[model samples]
Target: MNEQKIFDNIKHALGEAPRNQFTTEMHLQMIKYADNLKSITAKEFCEGVGLKPSFGTEFSKMRNLTQRLKAAGLNTNQL
Candidate 1:
């Protein structure tokens, strides 16, 4: 996907309002879960967060964000 679209999706998933609202704690939780896991597909990850898996590519995309978010101090849950 394009960078703009990817970013937009991430923003939506994180529930950032038009006013730029965000919850650092909730993001941290998502990040933590992404870090220490194996064989955990992106579809599964999105499902855990109440998102639908639209395409097979979502897993890779989400995985990348998960790592970045984790590095940014987002806490992840153990699976």
Candidate 2:
């Protein structure tokens, strides 16, 4: 998909929730590691994107975000 479309879908999935709100950093990281997400786990994806990899830590959040992305037709298999 196109970059703008991908980004828009991600934003929609992220929503505007206060806690665990999506930030520009995550946005950039998603874009940066878009390709890797299809194959690697979220924890690995986080580390690949320069973030700490936490096992069973905040994994649910990533899974939920990925679900939202999938619902938005984002093809989050990479995520």
**lDDT (Cα atoms) of all candidates against the true structure:** 0.50, 0.50
Angstrom error of the Cα, residue 24, model 1: value is 16
Clashing pairs in 1: 28-74, 28-75, 29-75, 32-75, 32-76, 33-76, 33-77
The list of candidate 2 runs beyond 4 A from truth reads 1-24, 27-36, 55-60, 72-79
Q: What tens-digit string does per-residue lDDT give for candidate 1 at 1-79?
A: 3433433455465675333544453344344443443466656555645556763354565557887766786555442
lDDT of 2 by residue, 17-79 (tens): 344555554653364435534555666544433445752245435555655676677763544
Off by over 4 Å in 1: 1-33, 40-54
lDDT of 2 at 66: 59
Candidate 2's TM-score reads 0.34
How good is model 1 by TM-score? 0.34
